[model samples]
Target chain A: MAEGTTDVPIAGYSAPRPRAHGSALHRMARRRSTTALLMCVPLFALLAGFVVYPFFYSIYLSTLNRDMTRFIGLFNYQYLLSSNTFHLVIFQSCLFAITAVFLKALIGFILAHVMHNITGPDQKLWRGVLLLPWVIPPALSTLGWWWMIEGSYSAVNWLLQQVGIHPIAFLSSTAWARFWIIMVNVWFGTPFFMIMYLATLKSVPDQLYEAAAIDGATGWQKIRFISFPMLKNIISITTLFSLIVTFANFDIVQILTAGAPANTTHVFATYAFQVGINSGNIPMGSAVSLFMFPILAVFAIFILRGVTRRTREAI
Target chain B: MSSATLAAGAAAPRRGRRPSIARERRWALWTSYIALAIFAVGFLIPPYFELVTSLKTSQEIGAGTDPWFTQHLFFGNYTSIIHNPQFQIFFLNSVKLTIVVVCVTMVISVLAAYALARMRFFGSQMFATGVFLTYLVPESLLFIPLFKELANLHLINNTWALAFVWPTLSVPFCTWILIGYFGSIPKELDEAAMIDGASHLQMLWKIFIPVAMPGIIAATIFAFTVCWGDFLYPLAFLFTSKQMVLTAGIVSTLIHGDVLDWGHIMAANILASAPPILIYAFLMDYYIAGLTAGATKG
Candidate 1:
């Protein structure tokens, strides 16, 4: 290591001089930092060109009319606001997100608690099993579910028949389609919540439980007062994350129903795709997609702020 | 043993908590087991049914054969797909695309992540936040304008066009993971090497990269999986069968206007899904830890 060569005043007072005039480590640091920066520039440029530019480009696109030459500022917005289909889609998107998020959180929390109560060996096995839905790629796994719910050869329908109930057309009927998609979304997502909650569960110190036990606290009491409070931040962040993703979900809705049954199941993304990419009406599609950004941005910002605040509090 | 057990039981309820607590524990245990069993079955049944269906013959499947039982083990479906040109082309295209995209993604991510994490510069925080937030931009919304951009660039039918595009989606998540991991490493290690007069490039290669292998692995897996499983991008970008990736190729060629070719379709789907599934099955701990690190460690 370099030390003590020439006397020189450093930041404030006189300090021992560095050992070597030009050190290999200093040269390495200089070279690597430059290399690292040089390496990063292209990626930053790529993101700027593709992601950042397209984001702003959509804003410009949203203002134009169908021909792409003429400007119709807010006309697409006016069309969206006035249309009955747009109104229905907005309502349905919320219904899909809110309902699925709530169910997933509740079920996930309970499942986590139950798993927490289980002993060694079994806990490890169950944890792996529970996370299977999340492990499989969403598109592929949802395709599997899609084939299962196919109207002609429906497995759930066959099961319903055995139970003396009429077979429901899960995908064909608008309401049933909405319900099943949300159910599948919940199923796919709850494991994420479970894992997060389980991790949080493990972090809650054993001493709190021991203290509660000393005070004659029941299991419910221990959980309600201790576990719930400890997990508030995670709960909020996870829920917010889930809400944005679910609201913007295109795959499940597209693959499951493709906005069929008179397009009753269409969320903003698929609906935008239908009007925009599928039909070549870029302006209208841009407007619809632009509408989704603000919602997601707001959710993301709020969640990030919450996370940072919690992090600050923790520190 | 019996006398000892009776004596111990007589002493156990002295505080009167044993019997009731035992009952409550039993109830909780039973309830937990039952709920877990129901959920386990619920999660298992659909995929299980799909597997069963995939193994059945087309005639058996169409004849309303009991999904639970197969008339005969038909490995012929799998064999026929292997012989099909379309299937083979799609498979090869997917492999080529996944490999190229992953390589490009890793390169961009490693360079960008190192800069964002270790470099002292203006706008690094803003850039990092922007990177993380980009992951939140679901591909659906972005694909519209991006599709037009490709059209303008004359890259719509290009298979390797994904080498340019896939990084946009992969880099943000991968870089964030890398930055988070790198940030957690102590600065003193770098400083000590600097004191010894080692070059920064050498230090990074010789020290930081090895120390952060898990992060690199996590990022690579994420990058590969996202590229491999991508549907919308491939669909929007590539139109011709020759240019198509496995996902779009299989759906287009097999489904063919809703006259579903179940045999070849199932075979192709199984083949397409096998890689990522195998990766996850073997490296679940890494995947889970990586995702958690991305999600909560941020």
Candidate 2:
């Protein structure tokens, strides 16, 4: 503590009395804290205006009638609960988020291992290629994907046509719509997982692997004993992060599928936009988007715990 | 002692496998290369197609031909999109909004992060945790409410609304990042600066900012990209074609009703997405560290 400054006065400098010193120090500390609080005003205002205020406002908005004239309590929620489209939204959101996140993690794990295995400069070359997909904005990249799968200009279907197979419409069928949505998401997200895993994988000590090698453990055995254990923290953390983002994904679904093929592919975001913005049913849209809240809150709790623990350890 | 147990547990079954480990390792390396090649092709195929489609004339794209090969390398799509004054506005708006938002986000985040990390104020711990939780709130979840709020303010169809709301998306994460970065500097440096009569702002500007340059750059890049790439807010709030930024503008203008312009759209998409991609390619380490550090600390 930088306390008792007045008690240790410098040469030829008169020290203040003990009581005066205490009061001065208290005033200084108070002033410092006041300045600190003032410094955070912009952040506090933004959070309150954008996040906190809107959070409660959405809760309020979700309860109103579609036109916002009449106060209807839980009507929108009840409507969504009863509606088949909302049911499909829930089912498809869960399926897409879980399946895509799982594939990303699995592929990321494998690629990270391979990247770690490469001893030469080729690692950089492969990494540059792999991470390219994530570098492009999701909206722009989804447009590229949409171009490839659109009618008549579909490169994939062209190749399939050559194989004596029928050229299928990729995004018009319900099953195919869900499949492609999850595919683009997994494609966009896997590089993030790979980069995260590869970073943590690099931190695992070489001696541990070499020691395991000398102990008669095979490549798979070394991974099971060493790499997996070391990577457990990051795997959970990155999976949780990716899970939240994937659950709330919009661009791919909006640009590529637009919740199409009979409203069979609606995630919360797209459905919210469909009802609220496109259809002009703001209350119902608010209700749709608010369905994403409970899961987000659940993830937030775990993310806070992990991130704070890491933050504390870093400090 | 632990190694002894581990070695004892594995030595019996692994004794004969040791001699073949070298051969097995070679095979694994070859398999890994093959796997990487597959992944590389899979990942590159989309962007490759984007490039291929952008280079060809409309007839080639309309012919339902193979998109893998670009026979005539034409630059008309790029030239047309660039020459169009409407696209020029969207591009300029994106650059302007992104620059302004990045500056604002950095100032707000760096100040708040420094304050929270350094000076103990009322509910600072709770405030710090609140920052992290705020970041987890996806923009998708709040777009509806924010839309209504912006409308009530009569800011709909106005680009100014985005200027006000865009930093909300970036500041929380950037603050969290700067807090993590600022937490690393030794306390004695600050203590010494304080003893020498440096104000909080001076210390932040003169000492901490210079020391934490990498973190600042990383956070700036993050803010810039988020603002540049934000599709939902602009899509909802900006109804006018002139009001939309690059991401939304490209869709609104390039796709007129049932007929979509593939060449110009891809070119615009390429142009719209180039900044962040180029930034990532150049600053991969800091970008990755800043991005993943939110969950998995660097």
Candidate 3:
């Protein structure tokens, strides 16, 4: 794309007086670069101040002691490494992120295919309804989940009782809390995956599917051969994106469990807040949060590779 | 029949095969409707139930009476929440912060997106990728350091703190979406403007901005929703009742320790989510377009 744009100006300039055009082109290039730099000033400044600077600062903070008065290199890491709560948080965070991402991706893929199979106004209406979970704020939506699952006014339990079953404690127990946390994460995130996959599904040209049908391909076979391969890039990118966000998730877990029932439900973000802010162990919290960095870095690299590869294929 | 005869018979009269195919399609369609209905009901029930619960009396809610419906209508939950001074502060704070952050994000994003999409400069590709990387850098990772950074700047507990911090979340994705939007415009339009000696700024202001209004609107909606819904940042930075935004404020204040107010809490949730929900209702297409474009295109 950049080559095509640059070619246009050069082709136009080639017809003009050669010597004059050369200097003019150089001047134009200089002017264009200046404009680009000037245009990017605000963004660079904002990223620098908020994103880049804070990122490095977090690394710095993680090295410091609890109060951050003195640098205690690797002490926070050493302490967190051996701590059982931090270990549980690591286990829980991985379990929550992976399970939620997998469930969301699977549910979203099925929902998108369902939406695709339906037609017209029905599809539009269902799409809108399905997106409600994603549209609402996580903090707010999780409150509704909390209310439904809370022991005092347990709506789900009430229904279970109606069915002549025992009312289970949803959030009061460790396993139940973790179960609800992942459930809520899947609920909130599936719509995003659905919308993304739906868009990708739309872009899969009808000709491919028609050709498949002509060859006597089954619905499952069409999806396997045509849909999955076509959607591989998008699926990976969205899953990785969700994985990173879920791995560092704070809102759903915090609002629902707040790492309750013995902190079995704590992920990196919630645990970081608990240790850093609530406990006033800033360095430890920073360390806890930074634990997400290496995993996310790996995911980020994979997503970037997928994005660039897809773009290259498109080109 | 023999296989050749069966094939010949199948090919001879397409009309004869129509009813069975139609029947199969009808069955498939009915099955899809059932599946979709079940999925939609499951998805919508929680929020719908919250809405219902919010409209019920506290006594009814506490009694766990009819989790699906209420006998008596009650406006007290909504009224009490709206009338509460603290809740009002949370609402106003959210509004103020969302507006400021959205404006800042759109400006920064538009300028950056324009540069990256239209201008050929050194390191532009790297910078564009950097923006995406920054977007992926979750606030959970940065909040601890940001807390210290804001403290050093004395911006903690100040609502304006978010105005500075939220762009880290909003700008990268907004810029990415806008880049896709801007890139989609035919190059000739901008190239023609350039040949006519239109400056880059004028071209951006007059041509790109006008043609890319949909994308800009999409980005604006995205930025607005993100700013409105963000939890981790405000949760970390703003501690005071006066400082808190709607999400953190309502959660912190309403659901005190062990004593839970189901009606008021649900009402607060509905109220807090109202802005984004209303926006999504009106601009659903733009919201989804921006999101998909950002995810798929980038």
- i-RMSD values for every candidate model: 4.3, 2.9, 2.0
lDDT of 2 by residue, A1-315 (tens): 222331233211323465766676678778878999999999999999988999899999988887798899998999999999999999999999999999999999999999888876788778888998888888888988988886644888888888888878888888887888989998999999999898888878888987776566878888898989888777887888888999999899999988998999999999999999999899999999998999988987887777766656655
> What is the Cα-based lDDT of residue B279 in candidate 3?
89
Q: What is the C-alpha lDDT profile of model 3 across B40-147, one tens digit per residue?
A: 898998899899999988778767577988897798999998998989999999898888889899888988899999886999989999988888888898899899
Residue clash pairs of candidate 3: none
Best by TM-score: 3
The positional error of residue A135 in candidate 1, measured at the CA in angstroms, is 2.2
List TM-score per model, in order: 0.90, 0.94, 0.94
Off by over 4 Å in 2: A1-16, A312-315, B1-17, B20-27, B257-259, B296-298
Question: Order of candidates by DockQ, top first?
Answer: 3, 2, 1
For each candidate, what's the DockQ?
0.41, 0.58, 0.65
Q: What is the lDDT of residue A120 in candidate 3?
A: 91
Instruction: State the lDDT at B8 in candidate 1.
Output: 61
**Residue A216: error of model 3 in Å?**
3.2
Candidate 1: where is the Cα deviation over 4 Å?
A1-36, A310-315, B1-30
lDDT measured at residue A35 in model 1 versus the true structure, 0 to 100: 68
Docking class of 1: acceptable
Clashing pairs in 2: none
Evaluation by TM-score, superior candidate among 2 and 3: 3
lDDT measured at residue A86 in model 2 versus the true structure, 0 to 100: 94
State the weakest 10-residue window (summed lDDT) of model 2 chain A.
Answer: A5-14
Model 1 TM-score, all chains together: 0.90
- B1-298, model 2: which lDDT tens digit per residue? 3444545565757545455446666888899999999999889999988988899888887876777888889999999989988799889888888888888899899999999878867788799889988888899999999999998999999988988899989999999888878877777778678767788899999988998888888899889878998888888889777777998888766776366668888888898989998898788778777876666542
